[model samples]
Target: MNKKTVKDFFDNLAKDWDSFEQPDSAVIEKILDYADIQIGCSVLDIACGTGILFPYYLKRNPLSITAVDLSEKMCAQAEKKCTDKRIKIICADILDTHTVTDKAERCLVFNAFPHLGNAKDAVQALCRHLVPGGILTVAHSESRESINNRHKEKAFSVSEPLPSASDLADIFSEYLEIIHVFEDESVYIVSGRM
Candidate 1:
């Protein structure tokens, strides 16, 4: 999809994002376990739709979090939900060379990876921002079939398909040390260290 198309679609939905989904505690646990998050770690929450991950991250007490999305309304809504001093919200395309760099120890692409114009190049760029041994994760609270079907159900801006497990394994292994891959009826998580 065109970058602006994706931005506008989400910006329009930002106000009602909570009506779309809430972070599932079980899925959040799986994500944290896969990433091996610890207290005081720096986190980059990419495409952090309406800051759904904010409360969970705060519970882990991260040192800092840079929540980013291409939608202005999305970021504004996130800023409103997240009152913590550690989180910084940015509305920018992650593919931009200089959008955010060398800042986070853990980079999370939650429920928003497939929309990328180019997933491989985008993954490489996100990996560039991590500290050595940092983690990069792409996750969803729903299964592969469910996510894809849901996107298809609506005339949404997400035009690209979420990669298969093997495809994602290749992408993750290409940019960072492959850690774990999980795909079940309700969730999917692919993570690695940078």
Candidate 2:
């Protein structure tokens, strides 16, 4: 999907996005556990809609967080919820060059991977900001089937079907060492080290 379409779709839904998509706490903990986010680590959150994962990332006590997204309204919503000096909300596309000036110890693409246009290209762009030995993770609180079915039912032009966890692992492997690839009825996650 094109950038404008994705941006507009998210922007239109920003106000009620949280109510529509509630994340499971246990699944979130599982994702964060697999993410291996250490205290004082720098983090990059891609497609950070309404900062859904911000509070969770904050709970890990990261030194800094750079949240990037394409929708202006979504970023605005995120900004309203974020008061921590450690967090910097940027309204921009992650696929763009120089979007994030600093490198991060952990880069998370949570609950938003399918909206990215090309899986390989998105992973390539995200890895550029990861410090050496840093990890990059793509995760979803919901199962692949559930997410895909929701998108299909919504008939959204901007949303693409999520790939299998193993396929995503292959994509991550092209740039970084594969760390984990797991999927089940509850969640989907793929992590790698740069």
Candidate 3:
């Protein structure tokens, strides 16, 4: 799908995006565990729709959080939800090298990877901003089949199907040391250390 089309699609739904999905706290805990977010470290929240995970990230007391999204309305929604001084919301594509100038200790792409134009290239770009030994996690609170089926039903031609856990692990392995891979009825996660 065209990048502009995807951005517009999400912009239309940004105001109500938080209501569309309720992420399970337990699963978020697991994902964060794999992320290994350290105290006082920098974080990059990619595709941070409505800042749904901002509260969770705040719990770790990170030094800074740079949240990026392609949709301006989505970024505005995130800004409304997260008023913390440590969080900086940017209305720009994280895949663009110039958009994020600083490296981060932890990077997360949560519940939004399939919409990327090129998943492999996106991962590579995210890895470039990851500090040595930092972790990057791509996760979905729902199962792969559930996410894919919903996209298929919606007929959003922009949405790409999520790969199997093992397949994603292999993809992440190209840029990071594979740390975790888990996919079950409830959730999908693939995390690696940079």
Better of 1 and 3 by lDDT: 3
Kindly provide the TM-score of model 1 when superposed on the true structure, using C-alpha atoms.
0.94
**Per-model TM-score versus the true fold:** 0.94, 0.96, 0.95
Candidate 3 Cα lDDT to native: 0.87
Candidate 2 stretches with Cα past 4 Å from truth are none
Judged by lDDT against the true structure, how good is candidate 2? 0.90
- Model 1: weakest 10-residue lDDT segment is 155-164
How much does candidate 3 score in TM-score? 0.95
Which of the numbered candidates is closest to the native, going by highest TM-score? Answer: 2
- Model 3: worst 10 consecutive residues (lDDT sum): 93-102
Candidate of highest lDDT: 2
lDDT of each: 0.83, 0.90, 0.87
RMSD of each: 1.4, 1.1, 1.2
Which ranges of candidate 3 are over 4 A from the true structure?
A: none
lDDT of 1: 0.83
* Better candidate by TM-score, 2 or 3: 2
Q: Which pairs clash in the backbone of model 3?
A: none
Q: For residues 69-129, could you state the per-residue lDDT of candidate 3 as single tens digits?
A: 9999999888887889999988888887788557898998998998886778878988998
